[model samples]
Target: MTDEKNSLYGGSQSSDAKSIDIYDENLHLAEKQKKIFLAICGVFISELNGKEFDVYMNTKTYTNVPKNANNIKEFGQINFESKDDFSARLFDRLQKTTHPHQFARISSMLKKMCSKMTSYSMTNSPTKLFYELSLEQRAAAVAKWSTSQKASIRQFYRTISYVARTAFWLNPYGIYPAIGYPGPDPEKNGPRFKGRTFPEYEFIKITEDTNDLEFDVVIIGSGAGGSVAAARNSVLVIEKGHHYHQSQLTLREKDGYEKLYELGGGMLSEDSSMTVLAGSNFGGGTTVSWSTSVEPSHFVREEWANDYGLIHFMDDDFVDSIKNIKNRLGVSSSNVIHNENNKILIEGCKKLGAPVATVSQNSASKLHECGWCGFGCRYGEKQGAAMTYLKDAKDYDVKFIQDCFVKRVIIENNKAVGVEATINNGDKKFKVNAKKVIVACGALHSPALLLRSGLKDKNIGKNLYTNPMAAVYGIFPNKEVKAYSGTIQSAVCDAKENVDGEYHGVKIVVGSCHPAMMSTSFPWKSPLQHKQFMLQYNHIVPLLIIARDRDPGQIKIDSKGLPKLDYKLSPHDAESVIAGILTSLKILVAAGATKIGTCQTEVEEFEIVGENSLNDPKFLQYLEKVKKVGVSNGQACLGSIYQMGTCRMGSDKAKSVVNPFGETWDVKNLYVADSSVFPTSAGASPMITTMSIGFYVANCILSEKEFVKKRQSAMLGTPNSTFTDNTNADKRSSRRRSLLSSFGSKRFSMSN
Candidate 1:
């Protein structure tokens, strides 16, 4: 071994991991490039030795913030776990967690990224290895990349930063202890939900020796869509993810990503301009999301009917569908207790005279003040798909098999007969023979599934819209505790939601944040500064600037047949995001924030000098800096919380993958019943919209008690139902019976 003083890399291997060597793994990258990549990782996350200890987070060489302004304090008292072999821990997890090919691609990119970073850094020659430079010099190098004149350089920085920071804050092993973050809180001692447990569902695990099964219908997902569509008996819902019950609902940040989210909660667009978060568990997003139950805005409905030919979206049936689902889920804002974050948002919006409204939750109107909603609701109060639709279907003996990945739909002579799938990551090959098939996979995966099934419709993966969001955080030091433990979005602003007159604008709301989530999404200024912000996690509150994106992205499959999102922030959408950021800053200042931070990586945080209004000259200048920096390609941190619009439902076959009834245009008897069927972006939380569409499409399949009958019955009541409710059970059962009997007798077919 080389002498300790002459070590080439800054640190030793991470943790106790022992396995494949990066160089031995036949990667297509050069040896020097691989070393360069490892060095860069060392620069971002390390143990902070004698020369590296920084208390005040002096980053002024790159950012314009005042030196030693003393807004944030040093955290020397606490014993941080990251101080002991953090670099080693991070690399150990990276090697074990990331796929080999993906790692190779990242290493190759890192070499190029470092060269450009140094050139832009205005430091020493690019010949020096990035890690060999002083700590500040290295951070300054990376900081310049965000403000680089070249878009490519900016994108490179964004990609690298995302990979590095997410690796650290998403908690490989040491992060929770290092940052002092608590894991899932499903305890009896809590004030809200007390010692409640979910009733068990009969979930079968698919095995290598499992036999073929037959059902009346086979649904290829278990989210809000598939759960509702499983209204018929003899139905089989195949889920790619396993069932995460109450005991494991809200896992720790890292565990949650591995167990509940798609792509380990790090899926990104092709350009890395947006981070896409989608659930992969049995209940899907409804299980893990913030449960913001909202009906479609009226303007969005008008667009679907007038522009996209989705007339039903504007009809009374749609309204009834939303009402029926909302009633069943008990979605209401009555019992919401806004956290300090939410309270400040409302106060600031009100002070600015911006229109604001309370956002509803599907927590059964129970007092559920959980900031960890994104990890999956620990409390049983969240009426997710599993608790509502799936629970209802369970009584009818609708079967379910978890850990099943449906490979493709089985098409025989232009009809979907069933589906072929591999369970437990190809441990078992099986086929489910069914009379009808419903592909209820969310937007990101539905298109890939269709394409894999050999459907040639051009719109299968097109027209995708994610209500992309950017966040701005404010520091409220006066709060006794760090401020993020209650409800996640109890309020939203309509001040700029319809700025484009077409409702193609933005919505402002408070985001649910915990330490791991807070730190990862917080752009890294320097190691010390980033850690300092993590120390201030409790005092920080982030506001989401969500946009009703007019521009669209598409989902495409890679050589491995996995979904690859292709999206870039179009100029118009970028403008809307910039406006939202400025508006968010204005609100923060008005709300009496001592310090406000923007997500743009190269920008300086605004520190309150004195008492000031929104129009204060210094604050106005900061706003201008924000606007000028804008949503530069990959420079600003943006996220897609509700991905939608792929495989959209419409009348024109050339423009849409599915028909008005949600049946695919290319094949009969196969339908899509997820957010993918939205005529455009739902322009609101998509849980209600996806569930309503699922309910509507399921009715279409059973040839429901005519539209008029549903309208009349719905008009007479509030449409609520419990798992044991039999009010509409007979009607639903009769429709399914008639449809099944027709199929059994060979007297009816979906193609008819």
Candidate 2:
């Protein structure tokens, strides 16, 4: 065994200069910080004694591990390998995504955890540190903290649990083989058919001291919006993340997050209310999003026009932009294959006579049944913006700089000039002068960037909205239902949506979670209890109830000048979320699930004995129990993959950060063409809406008589092709209006 002090588990630096120089060059955390991080996570890993291990192994008749090991120490919890320690993986993630300002907050949290250990007297040793606690003491503390009523106590448990479980499930060296999860093997996991083979894109990689960059238009993101806006000639796209073609895509959770996500994935909100997942890599959310491509609902568009005074939302040009984006991306419901989860949703909805709709995906050429959509697509079937829009931009000679972070938009007298950025984490810095500047860094970072650039407005980072989702897992013991495979998301149950007729409520959708996501989200009670739940992994199907929050949260810049969410679930939305959960439970009952569980810690699962219906006395009592507890922050895990409305677009200059034309009110020729500019909650996936806004913003630039150069004029589309809207939804039969008489909108107000 290697000495602990000299080990690569983020120990003290060795005296040798070559090894220290090489690894130290990339190291972001101090040796003490790294040690503290590892100690905090190590305590939560739940080291089991011999008897405890036996109890956990015998908890369930089923086992997710194909070759379930009996040894407790070999699981990597009790004893860690030097090279594959949690600190190495954790710091690697930090160096890639998290900024120093955020790290301070994290470090503070770690110190708090240590203080908690000392206060609880868990560490009987003289050191009185969390790392010095006995294995038995640490395990007992985790049990108490996981279900604690206090938010601060729960925060310690959740944050450590997220990192610890990720270290096991996401890493190849941790527990992949033990859990039967095969890491990224192209030959084994990729689709059978060889998908599209893209040409070698000449992305200018910044390796050395390169300077003096210039362009006609400089877009500061590579997401659903920015990729579409890159249609003009002489466009230079600066993406904070690097690109990966189909072959280079790593389907592994750990590698995918390090490469593609904002703040290294499983990102929680400021108050730890919801897990906010935002993409940051080459194609942004398009590269990492579940392939469901939904447009802003009709009611939302009307709301933007009527309430927000953004009448252009319903204009012909706006409608035309949506239509054009759909055509370009080939979004359709034709020949779609529903996975096990979607199939269960459809079957259950039919039994209850609920309205279900087929969702369109960007992949229309062939079946994109490859289940790893949350990670980048190795199959190249899903038509992400990188595949379609950015490829088109490249064909039109639009140059792109990969792995570049824009410091701020260079404004001269409040007029857009260009951008200043650092490539590959401050290795090289340069300024790109441009005629137009587009801020499309998504809902989270776009506002943060504006705040950092000395832009002041009450509405800069306000009006933030998310489609917060809660999960109800139904395990079918009779047959195999691998929820992680096949088409990720393809169907929806809108029986609960628009219950108010003003389009405010919830929608039921299916999600595809790999092992890492599943572990972090799967509700934990005790070590043995969680193991029992996970043993049913292949049989469990999740129905995600997404509440379209009415009361919006605001994004505030923290002391580090970074974006932080200052939002909580409002009473109105809490009712909606709880109502959706109750409805989902009924659907699962109708689907004839053997056992049903929720993300909430207090709610007990209702396992069927012989046969049970929604109206059965036992199930009814369980439903009552769920409603009694309701939804609250820190009680359960709530997650949101969708974020919007931060740098909002509206007609009123006083109310919105950007105007209806997508230009910022304070700055001329500077635009925001992303989900950040959504006037309100889109109430659906914002991919198509975001892309259409980008398309519209690009046209706005082209229409400008002063900025439109001769070279940009050649980008005029020659394809006058008009396609039929075969992807028509929302035309449901009137009989579907019957939304389960037992649980209606009136019952949602559980004030009694």
Off by over 4 Å in 1: 1-31, 47-104, 110-127, 131-137, 150-152, 172-183, 186-194, 481-483, 704-752
lDDT of 1 by residue, 492-599 (tens): 986777656777889899876765457656677666667667655666778898889898989988664667888888888888888888888888888888889988
What is candidate 2's local distance difference test score? 0.70
lDDT of 2 at 153: 65
Pairs that clash in candidate 2:
none
The candidate 2 region of ten consecutive residues with least summed lDDT is 1-10
> Number of the top candidate by lDDT?
1
Q: Which ten residues in a row are the worst by lDDT in model 1?
A: 2-11
For candidate 2, report its TM-score. 0.85
Model 1 earns a TM-score of 0.84
Report RMSD (Å) for each prediction in the order shown. 8.7, 9.8
